[model samples]
Target chain A: MSAKPIPGTPVFTGAYAMRGYALNKMCYSLNAAANRAAFLADEDGYCAQYGLTPPQRAAIAARNVAQLIEAGGNVYYLAKFAGIFGLNVQDLGAQQTGVSVDEFKAKLKAHAIHNDAVKAGRLANV
Target chain B: MSNIIGSVATSHIPAIGNAIHKGLQKDEYWQPFFDGFPPARAWLHAAKPDVAVVVYNDHGLNFFLDKMPTFAVGAAPVYTSEDEGWGIPTVPPVRGAPELSWAIIEQAVADEFDVTTCQEMLVDHACTVPLQLMWPEGWEGIRIVPIAINTVQHPLPSAKRCLAFGQSIGRAIRAFAQTLNVVVISTGGLSHQLEGERAGFLNPEFDDLCLNALINKPELLTRYSAHEIVELAGSQGAEILNWIVGRGILGGAAREVVRNYHIPISNTAAALQVLEPA
Candidate 1:
């Protein structure tokens, strides 16, 4: 590891929002057809079947989609939020699995898994 | 009877929750909206769940941008919310269900779900602070399963894919065959951008539409192309998939329990919902 510090001055203003082609492709291609129809039908039947009025269903539909869009898709944001739950992402896979960085990286690379920060660091370490 | 229950949908702007706990809600633009949650208090108290399987996104707390997992489940016995410089005041640590956690982890893995088994985790700002203000009372006798989704960056799982993940988890939980009644919680979203000049925003129409789909028609919500959702909601708003997974785990057709929507909570729409079993 190396360190470069400038006294009383900021050195770099780097910003990174987690994004990648693999993730975008996953989002673009993943589809749930039956699930969508089932959900729509359930909302409709609520009036006759469950006793919910149209306005109520409308409100619910509006709210449900809003909720899904707001919190459902982003991965980098999710990891950041999970941190609030006390699960810190230690870059080293040593927290619980007892796998050394080097060992974990080798295993992950051999398996062709490359999205892990720990594995990436370990590759550098190796 | 294997019945369908209610669902919760809320915006999880990390900064807003922290602001409320620190008493910054009033000092900032979040004051009026933060005050909106009082009415929903009664609903939360009445439908208090014994175990809350809180589904949320990890904001680089546990996993980093270097390498991220699509979905991770916490099978730990107990968890402590980590303080990410946005101090949480006098909140008790969250309790866990070691038994259920282990069982589900084993089941999911056996079912080929590449589950991450965490023995211990410092519950950070993302999970606890919002949960604290959201549920209060710390929910006694109620255990918690902290599940993480990959939502921060691009190239993440689609909303439909997350629902599939949710269904898998629901199957695993039902397989537990225990006497304990569980409450599945999906928290996050409704809209409010997180980056660039458009960061602090609230699309009420969009937010309402989302909540409706989550409570009355989750299946419909799931089919939304990720791009469409991002178009309707902000890009950062995609974290709602965590909540969708919870709804998916609970079998999609959730009854609405409570709904509260507020905007400008420090650049967040700050919506909250508590779904019940129908």
Candidate 2:
């Protein structure tokens, strides 16, 4: 599904598609130690087999499955959990969320020109 | 049926405070965003939860890539905000319930939930920072038990599994046999576009619906698969595990106190909610 927008915000066009609430809930009870271990061992593979993308897969591979399942419940938790495993979730996105750090600084530099009067001895804290 | 005293749903969108502090929220373009939270704060003040079990996703602050605990519980007495790169100014450390946390941990383990126990932690902005804003400092003698999730990573638990964990937590909390009033707090979102070219995006309509499902009808959300939430909320949205924790622990039905949402706070849309036993 395409992403929706807030009343005034424009639709953003980019490679990364807008997200939707489209997950299937899984039963999380473990009947045996073997089952738990198997789930842990194949957690990454399970997500991959089920169609989790690469960045998502990387996030799941990084954490202790037992702790993650208990604390975080799904993909959102896994994505954050991936951070613990050292995968940069932000960088995983193909689209850019905002201006780069350098870009931000350059914008500030350009904006600085508009307020030159305040920069002089005219404004106290400028 | 166990008495679910209260529950809360909050957004741990790390950038909210940053936007507020920088006067970005006050900017004309951002004014609508700041306006969304006043009602949220008012609602929380009325609910007045005694102790809160906050479930949220950590941003690689406490646990690292070397060894990450999928579901780690905080049994510490005090949880201080950590210096995650650009650190915040000095804020008093939040208090925690080591006893209750340990009790829940022990019970969850016995109940067959393998829970990780954390002693010392630098509670990142994703958790403690947001709590500071939503709930009052001294009211109802707030004590916390931090539970961190691995949401940003893949191979994470599915949505159904998360709701199941929340159910288990509800059972565990019910068996506590303590007289203290407990509130389950879940932090994270509906559909927020964080990161990438789609940053600064917000869907007020989706946010409203998510709050509705969480408060009056969580079952509505069950239809959504884990992948669906990620696609809608953002990849980082895996942090919504906190919501599942609330669903599990709160049990039965709830009275939602707050549902405030806003967007364009440093490339992330943010929302906050509070729930009470119906």
Candidate 3:
């Protein structure tokens, strides 16, 4: 089956996998507390050790989700990068949506309330 | 011969594990979610399946992005949960049913599904969280066969493929000669995306639609492409593909004994349902 691309979304395929191999490996290393601490102590040296490309290193330094995705960093592993900075998944989401963290959180709160109301038959679909 | 006595479909959110670890079960934020699990606990006690075929995805634990397997089955003698960045509380090592795991692997290969067989694999929260929630006493006596799917990176197995894989698992378990009562536990997703600009997106409508279809018309879920799942449920919402595997094990029909859905569980909606063979 021919792949149908989602508009405005970077789908992580084998091609992306190949492209982000080094970048992802670095992110995967964050699974260990020691590795996370090491990366935090020396981000550039760690990125250099992973052999990340200039673009990938730049994206990592910038904490740009779009750039990371474009550079082949899967969000699951990118989460480790976000965690290193004490950022949660929602923070990454906020970055991706170009919204402030508080705004993104408010949006999440609103969505949950709307969903609860929908479940209770108090509101129509949102 | 062994038979699938029951099936469970639930979200394996890591925060759920954290909640249990921190004794937040009675906390106002988690009381309702915790309340929903008693029926599951009751069902587990009543069913008392000898083995649990847990279907979950590895969250950068056992397999990294370097060698992501589309489908991998654990054939080890014991499965342990390792440190996943954050230091999670220690849980007892889960006993593995190698005999059953190998049987499924053999059948899956013969059935043309190239499954990666793992003799040693460390499980992550995706596998452990559900086990903690469903079998809080620890999986000491009951054995488990862990089936890991690729939901982390894209090009994930389609919902149709996951169902087919589950069907293959059903056949393998049924074909085994041992008189074992088995439960198929499919963990992950009911709609909350965890990545991209779409993170924190929760679609209770889509979650309900998926749950209703799972009970009445499971095949309806197959029509949704992974992208469509992300569109409706958010990017991480694609984890619902794991639940499709459980539905596949139940074949076309099963009795839904308990169902619970909640939103905003750390940027994801959570759903849990217990199904018994009809």
Q: Whose DockQ is greatest here?
A: 3
Q: Evaluate residue A26 in candidate 1 and report its C-alpha lDDT on the 0 to 100 scale.
A: 25
Q: Return the lDDT, model 3, position A60.
A: 87
The segments of candidate 2 whose C-alpha lies over 4 angstroms from its true place after superposition are: A1-126, B1-4, B19-47, B136-140, B193-206
Sort every candidate by TM-score, greatest first: 3, 2, 1
Clashing pairs in 3: none
Give the worst 10-residue stretch by lDDT in candidate 1 chain B: B193-202
lDDT of 2 by residue, A16-126 (tens): 111111111111112123433454677755454445444434434554332223222332323443333343323322213345544533332342332222212132210
Model 3 - which docking category? Answer: acceptable
lDDT of 1 by residue, A1-126 (tens): 122332211111112232122222222221223322443456454224434334434433543222212223232332222233343222112222344545533432332232122111222221
Assess every candidate by TM-score.
0.63, 0.64, 0.93
TM-score, prediction 1: 0.63
lDDT per residue as tens, model 3, B89-190: 557799999999999999999989999999999988998898999888767779999999887777788888988988888899999979899998899887
| lDDT tens per residue, model 3, A33-101 | 899988889988988999999999999888898899889888878877777777777777788888898
Best by lDDT: 3
Question: Against the true two-chain complex, what DockQ does each candidate achieve?
Answer: 0.03, 0.05, 0.42
lDDT of 3 at A81: 76
> 1 or 2, which is superior by lDDT?
2
TM-score: which is higher, 1 or 3? 3
Question: What's model 2's lDDT at B12?
Answer: 62
Best by TM-score: 3
